[model samples]
Each structure stands twice: as C-alpha cells, then as structure tokens.
Target: RRRTRLERSWRDCQRLWKWVSKKWLEKHRDVHNLKTIWFLRHPFKIRSGGEHKCFFCAYATKKWEENIGNRPPRTEKWTRCDYCPGRLVDSKFHCINAQYHYFNHPDLFCKEIERLNILRLRQETVGRSQGRPHA
Candidate 1:
C-alpha cells in the first residue's frame, strides 16, 4: 500500500504546524488564547487616508512618525515584524496569528494554507456522510 499525495502533504503540514505553534506559544507565554489565525496569500492592503498601504507597514510608519515628530527625518523606513517592531517585506505571504501580530515566513504560510484546505475537505466529507451538502 502507498500513501496518496494529499495524505503525504497533509502529514507534512501537520508537522510544520505543530513546530510553528509550539515556537509561537513559547515566545508569547503571556498570550493565553489565540482567537483566530489568518493566512493571507499576499500582504494585506488597507485604504488609509485615501491611499492603499500594507497594513503592517502602515502601522509601523504611523508609530515611527509619532515618535519622531520633532526630530530629523529618519534615514530608513520603518518596518514591522511578527515578533518585533520592524518592516514587513510585502513580497512574501503574511500570516495574522493574533491582533497586530503578523508573520511573513513563506514556508510556514504555505503549510498553514495546506492545513486549511485539508480541514475544509474533512468537513465536507463529514457533511456528505450525514446526508448534508457542504455549503
């Protein structure tokens, strides 16, 4: 007997998700609960002051400007990271694990996407078994 591609992929995704989740929990020990996790294929864009900006980047820029109102212009642009206050490169996929907490790791993002797909498939299967069409 051989395992199907989807089975193998799901197993890999589970392993990655476990590792990532553990690391996140260890680093954020104060956070007792994670309400929702969002894996966005691209950087989230929001309209701010009539201009579209990367959500994380915009937040970072706003904070920077506030702190340097009376000082000379910053030589470099402000950034934000999942674990720290830094810039988020828009070229990579973004993950919002909690409010204002963003992750831009490509590998972890891909695994999360796969995990979501697998969960959806499982839900549909269970629904069909109970004679209910998946909505």
Candidate 2:
C-alpha cells in the first residue's frame, strides 16, 4: 500500500527530531535529560478557503494543509509547525518562542532555563524536607 502524505510528514518529523536530539546531546554531553529540549507546535487555524497562519507570528502558509479538511484533528501526538522547528505541545506552540530566543539570544534562554531548574530544585528540596514523596 502507498503511504499517505500525513504518514510521510510524520516520518520527516521523526527524522528532524532525531537530528535535533543528536545535536543537543553533543552540546550538552553531561545532561542526558531530554525534558529540557522542548519541541512545540505553533498555534494555527484553517481558514474558510484552506489558508492557514500561525497566531503568534502571523506566519502564513498553504503548503502543509493539503487535504486537511478530510483529516481528523491531531490531538494525541506532536505535530511540527510549518513556520518553525518547534513541535506542538498541548495544542500550543510556545516552543517557537523558546527556539527563537535560543538562537537569537542564547544567554537569555540559558539563564531562564537555569532559573527554572533552580526553582524546581528548591521545590524538590522543600518537599523532601517535609517528608513528601517525590512526584
């Protein structure tokens, strides 16, 4: 049987993810945690004439939406944004902003991630001190 376009696109996304993961691992050799590398999908909508545009950046495209009206809504898995490298998370594309900041202002992104990690560590410490089970 022939593969559907959606299936092909999914395969491409998996390949892209693998490449990104490999690059990230090379850069952060000591950090094996994959959670820090977020893949997010930007917010988009299909208009009356099959047009689509990202809500956040107003990036417009019609290339990816072929036969979109016949396809079921994507809810269970991450979908790549047509405009950016981010994948969809919870139907939102907040990772696009993160990736943009990561490339354009590396220090800012690193600082923010560090701050968040510190806060998380503090919370964990507090929880452990209170005898709460690790979540």
Candidate 3:
C-alpha cells in the first residue's frame, strides 16, 4: 500500500489565489467590465448605418442598403475574437462607442471595473448596515 499526502500553508493558498486571480483577470477582464456595465445599467448602443460610428474598431458601417437591396437585419453580436490582438474578420462590425477593443485595452476595462466595484461595495455596505438592528 502507498499513501500520498500534501499540505499547503496559508501563505501558499494566498499566493496561489493571487496568481489565479491575476491570470483570470488578464483573460476575462473584458467579461468583468461587461458584467459591471450590465449591473450599472449602462447601455451599449449600436448606431444607425447612416449616423453613428462603431464603439469598437472605431469604423463606420456604411449604408450598404443603398448599394444593395434590403437585407436581413444584423442579429450577430460582436465577440472578443472578432478584433483583439489580431483582426479575425470584418463584417458588420457594429458597436456602442469607441471602446470596442475592451478585451485588448486593459486600461479602459480596469477603470470601468474599478468604478463599478466602488459603486457595488458602497451599495453592499449600506444595505448591510441598514439590515442590522439598532445597537
């Protein structure tokens, strides 16, 4: 019979958590930003063909209807792979504002994450205090 045992100290756990969190944030920072925006009810708008510029890529999807006849409405949502680190494809690249490259732009995503975290923490603190009985 053989037995194997492993033990990790508190410091080891903390270090592992820190490393995991850093890697996770690096990968899904944009996802966090997206969630935060959803929580804050911040709208990510898609502009009209003749009017607004795309939020990502910062390019205008010109009025293609004039060139061709009426086509199916754009139902595809943009994914991170579409544009970030490399441009995958460029088709109907609609978006909200100029911050389309949120996945690549950690600075922009981090700022938004910080702002939303502040708001969420403030709300949680107030809620917790309010629920407690007077002492």
Residue pairs that clash (backbone atoms under 3 angstroms), model 2? 40-87, 40-88, 41-87, 41-88, 41-93
CA lDDT, every prediction? 0.41, 0.38, 0.34
Instruction: Give the best candidate by TM-score.
Output: 2
lDDT of 2 at 108: 45
Each candidate: RMSD to true structure? Answer: 16.7, 14.6, 19.1
Candidate ranking (lDDT, best to worst): 1, 2, 3
In model 3, which residue pairs have backbone atoms overlapping below 3 Å?
55-97, 56-100
**Where does model 3 exceed 4 Å of error?**
1-97, 132-135
Candidate 2 to native Cα RMSD, angstroms: 14.6
Kindly indicate the candidate among 1 and 2 with the higher TM-score: 2
lDDT, candidate 1, 21-108, per-residue tens:
5656457332212112212322333333113123333444454555554444544333333211211223232456532232434335
- lDDT of candidate 3 over 47-112, digit per residue (tens): 432121122222113223232344434533233323311121223322222563333544443344
Clashing residue pairs in candidate 1, if any? 79-86, 79-87, 80-86, 80-87
Indicate the worst ten consecutive residues by lDDT in candidate 2: 51-60
Q: For candidate 2, lDDT tens digit of each residue in 13-81?
A: 344334444555467432223323322332223342122122212221233344345445774221324
